[model samples]
Structures are given as structure tokens and as C-alpha cells.
Target: MHRSERVSMYGWIWRHLPGNTWVRAGISLVLVLATVFVLFQYVFPWAEPLLPFGDVTVDEGGAGR
Candidate 1:
């Protein structure tokens, strides 16, 4: 693919972000925080039930005793 088409999602976002270096940095930080908030507040909780981690079993009476 061409360079433009090969550009990463992050690179595309950076190019589209408005303002100078400092303002762009601030906006990037806000975007990151917003993404994390959404993942933790909605995504993780919603997907938790679908994960296999809840079925974990431990061999308490076996090795490492």
C-alpha cells in the first residue's frame, strides 16, 4: 500500500489533531484518558462475564506446599 494508506491509526489521529505542539499534546493526553475511561467504565465490565478467568481452579493440595 502507499505511505498514506499505510499510515497507522495513531499517526492519522496525530495529523488530524488541531493546534501547535503543546495544544496537540494536551489534546492527545485528553484523548488517551478518555479512551482509558471508556475501556474501564464500559468495555472491561461488559466483557468480564464473557472471559474464561472466572472458571479458574487451583490445586491447593498439590505442589508448592
Candidate 2:
């Protein structure tokens, strides 16, 4: 197809992308990252720490029990 014809077609499809699409996409990304952070920082610890290499018996700074 001609360049102009292709541009017009692409423009029409681009216009149909909802105004809120970018907002929703951004919010979704933030939500996903927050969830992952929570899982790693809190949720995984509640269940069990993510890495076995980390201390299972000692708290931070390797203080005594």
C-alpha cells in the first residue's frame, strides 16, 4: 500500500486506543510492582524467607536469640 494510505489506516487505529488506556496501564504496572515488593518484603517472610542462604535462625545483625 502507499505510504499515505498506510499512515491513514494506522492513524485511525491509534485514535481508537482509549484515552484511559495509558492511565490504566500505568496503574496496573504500579500495582504489580507494589504487589511484588510486598511479597518479597513481607508476605514471603510471613510464610518463609525467599532465600535459604539468608539466616533462618538469627535476626538482623546476627544478634543472639
Candidate 3:
């Protein structure tokens, strides 16, 4: 809840991660990449049509004149 609590929580996770710094870094990188891959492959495709970014139009009335 507080700043120290959040920091300690992260510290606990870091301490619990197995292996030395390089191994832990590799594991963290893989986890991050996997999360991104899942989000792009499944989540983004399903949510794309619901987003308002697709069709954009601008009208200048004097263009045809």
C-alpha cells in the first residue's frame, strides 16, 4: 500500500528469483517477451474493432469547389 511496502514486495520477488544476475535477467526478458506476444496475438486482435482509431475522415468544404 505504501511506498516501502511496494518496494519490499519487489525486493522479495527479486530475491526469490533463481540463479545469478544474468540468469535472472534472461528469465525476466523471456517473461516480458511472452507477455507481449500473448497480448498481440490474442488480446489486440479481439479489441481492435472496438477501438475508435480505425476510420478517420477530414472534410474541407472548399476542396470540391
Candidate 4:
């Protein structure tokens, strides 16, 4: 509230919390997103499959077909 006291949120986080905690959190998030992306694109797609034989048609009257 006073002009003499400056608020530093970034400094407070790094000072009060363990540095590795932040780093690990960031790494975990990146890994999670990468896994999801890989699964969606290669392992198993949510929208459409990109397998070796291409998207199969189990339902003949599906929207895509």
C-alpha cells in the first residue's frame, strides 16, 4: 500500500517455494501434453485414426462415411 514497499510476486514464489518444485511442475506439464499429443496423433486419435490401414468403418452409416 505504501510507495516504499514494492510487491514482487515472482521473487516471492522463488524465494518461499523450492526451485525444483516449480521446475518439476513445468516438466510434468510438458510431459503430459506431449504424451497426449503423441497418443492422439499416433497411438490413438480422438477425432480420427491414423493407423497403418487407415480409419476403418465398423459402422457403415457413420457420419464420416
TM-score of candidate 3 against the unseen true structure? 0.67
Better of 2 and 3 by TM-score: 3
Q: List the residue pairs that clash in candidate 2.
A: none
- Candidate order by TM-score, decreasing, is 1, 3, 2, 4
- lDDT, residue 34, model 1: 100
Q: List the candidates' TM-scores in order.
A: 0.80, 0.45, 0.67, 0.40
Error of 2 at 9 (Å): 33
Better of 2 and 4 by lDDT: 2
- By lDDT, who's the top model here? 1
Instruction: Please list the residue runs of candidate 4 whose C-alpha ends up more than 4 Å from where it truly belongs after superposition.
Output: 1-19, 45-65
Error of 4 at 7 (Å): 40
**Deviation of model 1 at 39, angstroms:** 0.6
lDDT tens digits, residue span 1-65, model 1:
77767878888888899999899999999999999999999999999999999786888787768
Q: What is the C-alpha RMSD of each candidate to the true structure, in Å?
A: 2.1, 10.7, 3.8, 11.1
- Go through the candidates in order and give each one's C-alpha lDDT: 0.91, 0.69, 0.84, 0.67
Cα lDDT tens digits for candidate 3, 1-65: 77766666557767888999999888878878999999999999999999999676866665676
Please state the error at residue 18 of candidate 3 in Å.
1.0
Candidate 4's displacement at residue 15, Å, is: 21
Residue range with the least summed lDDT across 10 consecutive positions in model 3: 4-13
Name the TM-score of candidate 4. 0.40
